[model samples]
Target: GVGAGGDMPNWMTFLISDVPLYLIAMPVAVVLMGKSTVIETRKFNMKPGMFFKLLLMCLPMMWVGSMVGSMLSLALSDGEATNRVADLAMQTNIWNVVFLVILGPIFEEWMFRKQLIDHTRKYGEKTAILLSGLAFGLFHMNLFQFFYAFLLGVMFGYIYMRTSKLRYSTAMHMIINFNGGVLAPWILTRVDLDQLDKVSQAAENGNVAAMEQWASQNATGLAIMLVYFLLYGAVILAGFVLLIRNFRKAEFYIAPEELPRGVRAKTVYGNVGMVTFIVLTVLLTAISLFL
Candidate 1:
């Protein structure tokens, strides 16, 4: 039903469909789960340096997850897979930026990190984080997003656990969304990709004159794209180094009601509801990839 507003602007569609679901349905679901499941707001006090460090460490993970998801989708669909989210990002406007970079993160962090983690952390911090990651991944219901979303969800969940504050995770979410939904798209819009492709084709065919003509006209755009790629590559490399250096420092606390290691899998996934949710999401992801 969320997709039913296809004729409307992206922001309007999201407001009419997703806002109600997040603002109303999510809270109602939490109420139905019982008051004990509610998460109380905590002070937002994470340092800027710490946030940057966390974000840097997460970059490589996000890159890897995205690569894996793309590879799997291409393999499954014989290289014909399409990413709707990416398509929407490419079409982003100011209103879309508001929803994608701000409102989306606020509601999503509230639902996935704050609410879900609070409800499940009683089982164990690790368990809660894993569940939150998996659920967040599946919530996308598309193969293109599941892996990167899952990895980011786990990272955000860890941040929430350490600070017991929504602001840190929410801010992190906002930054990532802004990069993907706003900054990256804006950079891409400056480049004439169709002309670039033609230039490439001309070069491959030994038509140097044609390539030079296109380059002369679009040199600035090419320079901008090249700089973006270089900067992005540097960040990704730094992220990998940070991830490796800090991997061993990661810690998980045992909850007071921690389930036994032997039964933890059963405790988390043996339920009918979770199994059904997983099955449905997997089916949807498969459909999105192949059909």
Candidate 2:
């Protein structure tokens, strides 16, 4: 989901709605039949100091990614990008920024990285981790985003794997998203609304070259951004190396198929609910782009 509506916190909205539905359903059949299952946080076996180290390392990487992405969004996504579709975006809603930067990472990390990925990888180890990252990336529709999301997913996945703690990667993700999704909007709000109009005009007219020229004219801000990128990327790279060097290997968690048969359905759904969820996810995602 693209998150909830109104001035209410998206998480609160989900807690009031989706969480209840999912929890009540329990995917009992899946748990019972044992095809595959979500991660049980209580089962996590973390090594000492891993959580602290991961948090220390990821904080900077997340900052760098966020800053760079925001700068790029402002720089490259000016008027001509997205085919003059900027008007359709939720520029006025600060929640857009919050959701993209904060809420989004938290939920995805909780769902894909912490739940699905964790479940698979805990059982199969690195192979499972890789598959989880792949699934996480591909789950985002369209080719343009696949490559970027995939790479980011791998980085976060590896960190999650190394730490065996959700907190570290979740922090990392939130930081990375905060700049573009949150901070940028905050900054933009302070700027004269005329700039948004200017941006919209440039896009609506398909004047990409003008947008580029405008960015060049504001080279000071852009240069500050470039420096930020280099510094942050460097730190994240080092943290990644450190995580790898510190792994204490353990046996993978057993998959559902190996568990006892259940009285519940093999999955949360037969074929019907499964298709419906996927369809709804895609439809909502498209609708989000419009918002």
Candidate 1: list runs displaced more than 4 Å: 1-9, 12-25, 35-44
TM-scores for candidates 1 onward, in order: 0.90, 0.47
Residue-level lDDT tens digits of model 2 in 1-291: 223355665445535544443454334423532555545444354454765565455544444443553354345535222311122123435544555556567767766566656555534445556555555544553222334455567667776765667776677677656654554444444434455468668877997776666666656655665666676567667776765664454334454443233511233223464446556645643444344
Error of 2 at 226 (Å): 7.5
Q: Name the weakest run of 10 consecutive residues (lDDT summed) in model 2.
A: 80-89
Candidate 1 structure lDDT: 0.81
Off by over 4 Å in 2: 1-34, 37-93, 184-291
Give candidate 2's whole-model lDDT.
0.52
lDDT by residue (115-154, candidate 1, tens digit) is 8888888888899899989988887777878899999999
Q: Candidates' lDDT values, in order?
A: 0.81, 0.52
